[model samples]
Target chain A: MGLVNSIFATVQFEILRVLTLRRLSVAVIMALFPPTMIFWLQAGGALASPGFIITLFCGMVCLLSLLLWSTSNVYAELEGKSWAFITSRPYGRWSILFGKFLVAFLVSFIISWIALSLCMLVTGDLDFNILNDGKEVPKMQVWLALSGLLFLASMVYAAIFSLLGVLIQRRAMAIAVVFFTVVEVVFAVIPAVVGKFAMSFHMFCLLTHWVGWVPPSAGQDEDANEILQDFLNVYGRQDAWVHLAVIFAMTLLSLSLAAYVICKREYITLEDSQV
Target chain B: MIEFHNVTKLYKTVIGVNDISLKIEPGVYGLLGPNGSGKTTFINLVMGQLRPSMGHLSVFGMDPWQNDGLLNRIGLCPAIQAHYPFISGLKWVAYLTQLRGFSRKQSHQMAAESLAVVGMEYAMNRAMSSYSLGMRQRTVLAQSIAHKPELLILDEPFNGLDPKGRYEMTVFLKSWVKEGRSVILASHILHEVESLNPSLLLVSGGRLLASGSPQQVRSIIANCPNSVRVRCRQTAELAALVTGNFEIKSISINSEAEELEIESMNPLELLKLLPGLAMKNNLLISELRSSDDSLQNIFSMLMLIHRGGMRLPE
Candidate 1:
């Protein structure tokens, strides 16, 4: 119980620091970049599909910013030689990593959500008439589904990056690039079972099922959001619940690996921190 | 409070610490050694930051490596050159204390009190990066003591302090010892370690050479011969008088240089007797000093023994 509270206190302290005027301003700029760019493209009359644009923005810009922050959580300690402060605490290593991971995830999720809402400001009347001639799906449902996907993506990406920090903190930026380029982007873009291993794979499946273009049916509103309504299996491309479970499981697995490494490895900072 | 049995820590091809055994029933113990003498490695073993390549170590009767309970009872003020730039000293200490299971109110209160004790209360709100070296050292010390652990380990805590800061740290450490908590102070400087505690463990070349109070260490070296040099008009007379004393093991005089060299088993006693003897001989002792610094001699002896080329007197 004390450990849990301690973790929360750390997260609280970190989040506060992270949201300081200077860092928060940078976060806001980065978060709003996607929507601002989308708005500009739409104004230029060169915008193709808004869904594709928004998803790309979330995956690329939002994920990158979040990944950068989460990865830095561990590397910052190393670079600053402040790992002693956290490792020397009674709650120990795992709690420290978990606290960092949580703060990063929450910060990224909140910023991304704010960015999504800002996009709505430009997209206008997102009582969106994204129709494929099927039964009308409410705009509220579309928003809810997109929000869920964003939340899960934030969580999964944060965990993976946090794991990378635990594994190879000194090379965090370089490893992050390799992981993002190879796994999240290239693997996710390709249509293979191997892509299923990436967080983007589940996100793409969820996106497709939630807003996939459906075949035209008679006696249906022509300008309605055509979305799957199987609450448990919303994106029936594959089971959404199963994908959710996989993502959560991967988070747990990554967290466990991080904890194990932290507990077992003899970090120089820890050794030299002896008072 | 701490124990090591045949503990050896090997880093690939180099041995950071060699086979050794020790038990510390601590009030305050100074770990004295030069750079690369395994002081940090030994401290790391005690803190459970590293596992022994062979043998075993225990602190507070629990294994330190990943032992959260044991760690909770220990506080460390590591010897670091800098502090985190982004976090204020107050926040860092409070956050660490909170992690030690203290309530938010308690953590903050303890942090404030600890900072006050270290005379850092005025600048506690400032980011650590803004602090001067002395201030940073104080802040680090504050964070370690905020939890009020049973044992506190300070690794060269006075490394970068100004003279006044060093004096204040000595006073605080003295008071802390009076409070009956255990402390392990690691330092390279002899006088500094001597100032903190008479009891010490000296290491050289990754091996423990000596362990005892200052008086005991002095006694061990009492009969070890060391050279005393003298330049005087009456070198012959001075050498004759000095060599006659049992404390003086041998003597040689050079009339050409008006110099006298005496090797003494009991150098302190010989030193005490020199002036009296010189006066009796009516010798003008223009210059007189021991060429041998005792600390350096002890270290040389230890290294010799470590290399298996010399035997330490039982």
Candidate 2:
């Protein structure tokens, strides 16, 4: 009970610390990203397809927000002089990391939702049937499905970035961006069994399975659907539960790994080290 | 209580502390050293912000590395300044107290009282960025003592403090120790640590040179060769008289300043002989200064003793 209370206090402390105007401004910028991109696509006469929009929300808006907030959580404290004050408390180090992770997850989740809503507004896609091909899925149903995907993506990305922050404090942000590009972006899209291991793979699989989202190329290339279908057939289209399970497991694994490393490794400021 | 058994900390290539094995009992212990002498590193090792690269360390009978239970009994006022610009001093202290498992109300009460103790109650509501360095130091001290831990480890607590603030801190530390609690104060200033009258731990070059009561350490320092600089009109005559009467190790004359600098194996006898020699010879002595009292010279002499290059007077 004492430990739980301490953790809650840490969360409250983080809330106070993270509520500055600079951080809020960054959140606003993240919220505005997807809609601005959608507006630009519409002006260019590009198909602002549901797949592109979903990917933008999950990969760009959500991940960008996490990259800003989560990847620098530990680094910021150590770089500043506040590392000792918190790390010296009982369960202080662990609680601080956990609190930052929670705040990062929620902030990214909220920003992603706002981005999705603004994107929908920009496209005037209130019907949300753009993905279901006139099969008349209720607007709220599709909205909830998209919201679920964003929530999962936010959790997974936040946990992963938090681990990166702990593992490599000096270059966490740059390395996280590179990891996102190479692993989540490039590797997740490969039409092979190895792609299933990436968190983004489960996210896209759930998006296609739940929201009936198809690739933007499906309308232009006649065989794009056949290729996607062939790929899914070979991979065996699992249930939505399987994708969700994989994502949740990845999130848990990342968070646990971060906790393990943080508990085992000694983190000190350069000033302290040199002294 | 804390114990280090052959503990050494290596930061990649640089050594922080080397082969330090000691047991610290409950009391006030001043970790004394010059700048960059690994005093902070030793404190960090005790705080568990660092782990020993070799050997082992235990605080309160438990390994301090990731020892959450042990930390509950310890409070650390680190050398690093707090940098939360937006939060008030009260909130900052309260937040840290809350992490000690206190309820919000209790934490605030404790923070308030602790801030009051450190003479920061009036400005506790102001944002930290608006604080003077002394005010921030007071706030940092408040947070460390707010939880009333059994052990309070302060690294350079007197830094950024006015004389009045230093006095208040000394009084507070005295009271804290009178309560039977322990403190480990780390500082490079000898007088600042000396005023506390703490058991001294002198370190140099990442090694513990000596550890004992103030008198014990002072006695060892007293035996080292003492250098005295005298500004006098008759530099040559004074130098000649001092060399003949006292056991002088080295003598150097600065012709421009008309000063005679002398190193003596027995500083007391040399100092006693100075006034009479000047009075008898009508030599005007303007200034007299000793280098042996300084921490740098004391440490150099201790290092020499540790390296078998010098020995204490019999």
Candidate 3:
């Protein structure tokens, strides 16, 4: 019971810290970037397929915001010179890390849901007509399933980025940028077994398995079929359950590692009075 | 309540505290030293903020590093002045109080009470950035004592406070000591530490020069070099009389001013000898002053011993 109160205090403080007006502005801009781009592209007669909506809403909006918020939020206390005051109490490091991870995950989840929902509404893709394997899928079920996907992405990515922040605090920004560019974008699409290691690979896999692929008909032109096949193959490599399990396990591992690091290392803050 | 067995802390090439062993019982004990004299380093070691590089240290019979056993029983009022500018002092203290495992409601009450203890009750609702330096220091003190810790470790607690604040804090600390709590107060200011209590641990060059009552610390360096200026009607005769005395180290005679500046190994002895020597030589000793008994003088004496390889007075 005592430990629980410590963790709760940390969680409450994290919520307060992350929900500031400046951070809210960053979150707002993060959530709107993709949908606004989608609308602008739509004006130029750009494609508005299901694939397009998934990439815009899930890849750009959901994943990027989680990345942006999680990295800074983990190390924010130390940066602001508030770590000593908070950590010097009975509250241990495990409690502090757990609180930060929970806040990052929850905020990312909420922002992803709201932003993706807005995208669907504006793009006229909120149709209550999702059919899977010739079975009528309810509109409410589809909404819930999509919400679950957004939550999953936010949960996993936030944990990973938070772990990064803990492991390499001073270089968190540079390390995160390099990791996302190298692993998520470049290597995740290499069509090799090594590409399976990236989080984006699992994200694509989960999406493909959740929303079954509908191949373009044989009567269709080769160019259209080729585009559809490449898209399907890129995102349809593994079973959805496997992807879900991997994401969940990785989240647990990252959060645990982050807690361990916090507990062990001494944070030598530049707080001495130069007498 | 605290023990350090041959403990030393080194920051790469620089040594913060050297191999030193000592013990302290529960009372208000001052850790006195000038700037860069290992006062902060010793406080950090006791607070579990920095682990000793060699040897062992324990507080309340347990390793202080990451020890949650006495988390509620040890409070630290740090000297650093970092604070969140956006929040009121009440909110900041309350937040830290909650971190001590109190319910939010209980924390609120305790924080207000502690703030009141520091005479910040009226200003608790104001943003900390808008506060004067003394008010901010009080707020930090409130956070440390809000949990009702059994041992309070304060580092340079008198840095920015006015005389009034210092008096209030001194009173509160005396009352606190009277209640059977222990405090390890670190400060470079001599009279400030002296007012808290006569017992102090004198440290210099990362080594323990002396540890006992203030008088004992003073006795250890009794042979420290003293600078004395003597103005006489006949300066040459006084210098001639005092030049070969066993107490005097060096002498400089200024003819135009009719003064003799003398450095002595023992000022007290030289003072006793001066009047008689003047009388014997029939030289009128008009003015005499010894500028080597104050706080800074003691530190200067310690440094001279440290650098000049002079041992402490027996």
- Evaluate residue A124 in candidate 2 and report its C-alpha lDDT on the 0 to 100 scale: 70
Query: Candidate 3: where are CA atoms >4 Å away?
Result: A18-20, A47-69, A72-75, A125-146, A190-193, A213-239, A270-275, B229-246, B252-261, B271-308
lDDT (tens digit, per residue) of candidate 2 on A1-275: 66677778877777787689987888888788778877787688764355455555545788888898789878988888788888888767777778888888988899889988777677675233334443545656666778898899889989999999999998999999999888888888787877887898888778767756555642533354565567678778899999999999998999999989988888867876686
- Our model 2 lands, by Cα RMSD against the true structure, at 2.3
Quote the positional error of residue B97 for candidate 2 in Å: 1.6
Model 1 lDDT per residue over B256-305, tens place? 99988887766667767788877876887888777675566767766775
Query: Among these predicted structures, which one has the highest DockQ?
Result: 2
- Model 2 clash count equals 0
Residue pairs with backbone atoms closer than 3 Å in model 2 (clashes):
none
Identify the leading candidate in terms of TM-score.
2
lDDT: which candidate is best? 2
lDDT of 1 by residue, A180-256 (tens): 88998898655567777888777756655676532233223233233233322432356667778889999999888
Candidate 1, which segments miss by more than 4 Å at Cα?
A19-22, A125-143, A189-192, A213-236, A270-275, B219-277, B286-298, B311-314
TM-score of each: 0.85, 0.94, 0.86
In the range B1-314, model 3's lDDT, one tens digit per residue, is 89999999887667788897998888888888877778777877776767888999999999987776666888988776656656789887887887778888998999999999999999999878799989999999999999888999888898899999899889988887888888989888777877766478878778876678877765654557777888997988788788766467788889999888998878667777888888887889988887565666687677667666676544
Superposing every Cα of model 3 onto the true structure, what RMSD results? 4.2
